[model samples]
Target: MPNATATPPAFRYQGWSLFSLLAALVLLMTVMILIINPDLTEGVRSAIRATARSSFVLFLLAFTASAFAVLVPSPLSKSLVRERRFIGLAFAFSHLIHAVLIYWYGQLNTEFWPGRTALGNVPGTVGYVFVLLLALTSFKSTTRLIGATAWKRLHTTGMWVLAAIFAYSNFKRIPMSDWYVLPFGLICAATAIRLMGKLAQANKRQSLQRVA
Candidate 1:
């Protein structure tokens, strides 16, 4: 008699794959924007802002996934948990485009890169550093190298830094245009959820300690 073995199921598309597809589509669209309007200075600046907005959306999705999944226990939120890393990577990719556009803007118009002392300049630069750190540590190898506790510390601090940067950047822009309110509100709401989640976690820890 011949021995039979069970074959594993074929690979299915899930969070990471979907995220890569979506990132590619966004990049294609951004490229098309430049094709349509060959004005590199203003056009690149517009693309940078738009890409930053999209990246913020992606970051929020990843940021809220785990907390919301536990809070609401829905398939969508849980799916977000599974794809959180992918979503984060997608955010990084979006921001990469944003960064490139910013550089292009600077090159196209020598005065485009504002002074570091300018309102958003310093914080934006800090935020990019955090983004790079987070992106580097998103992988299993880097996480292992950093150790679990250090990884948590780095990620937690980085998340808050990015959140504050987003909040400040949008809030500062409100004087220029009211359209900034949307992103500002979204970041604020996400920050609220994060705070609530932290409070809930602390309460649960206290309850567990009392029981023990």
Candidate 2:
């Protein structure tokens, strides 16, 4: 039996605690958006874009945290590893806000939406599908339902697919402004970092086995 005197795991690690905080953060941002803007439609669009940026950044952070912890010798990276699930859920929450605003956009002016053809929906739809799958399987029980090996395959494929979507989305908009370069560069850098970290961790593990 577990020790009765031991403290429970931090809320970030145990069940829905971290998700609740993420929901609150998204909600507060939403409320502030409404309060601050005189033009609600513009505000909603701005909020959508803001949430888009937040979700992308969160996704990058979540995707890299574990390998980063393995590669780096730092308390911060290790903390990020511990909070990986929380960070992922936070990314989902941010995207949930993004989805809400998108729906609102469609309701207010659906013509602003892309044509119903798969062309316009290609990457966006793909990203959402993976996010939903990832979020659902994020639970230990749900992950077990698919078996660990299959779950690993799905997540690995999904993460790469999502990363490509993010990179493509930003790169395609280069005509808008030079400012887009920064985010595109950041995503590319993060991807490279994750790959390098994984290789380093793999080499370390092999070395340990050899030593043992």
Clashes of each: 0, 0
lDDT per residue (tens digit) for residues 44-137 in model 1: 7778888988888888987777778656766667677777888888988998888888888878887666544575477988999999999999
lDDT of 2: 0.82
lDDT of 2 by residue, 1-212 (tens): 99986444433443367667766877788879877989888888888878888888888888888778777757667667677777888888899889989899778766767546768787999899999999999888998899999989988898898889889988988789887788899889989999998899889899999999
In candidate 1, how many Å is residue 149 off? 0.1
User: Least lDDT summed over 10 consecutive residues: which range in candidate 2?
Assistant: 6-15
- lDDT over C-alpha atoms for residue 176 of model 2: 93
For model 1, the stretches where C-alpha displacement exceeds 4 angstroms are 1-15, 114-120, 208-212
- lDDT accuracy of residue 170 in candidate 1: 91
Please give me the total number of clashing residue pairs in predicted model 2: 0
For model 2, what is the error of residue 41's alpha carbon versus the real structure, in angstroms, after optimal superposition? 1.6
Clashing pairs in 1: none
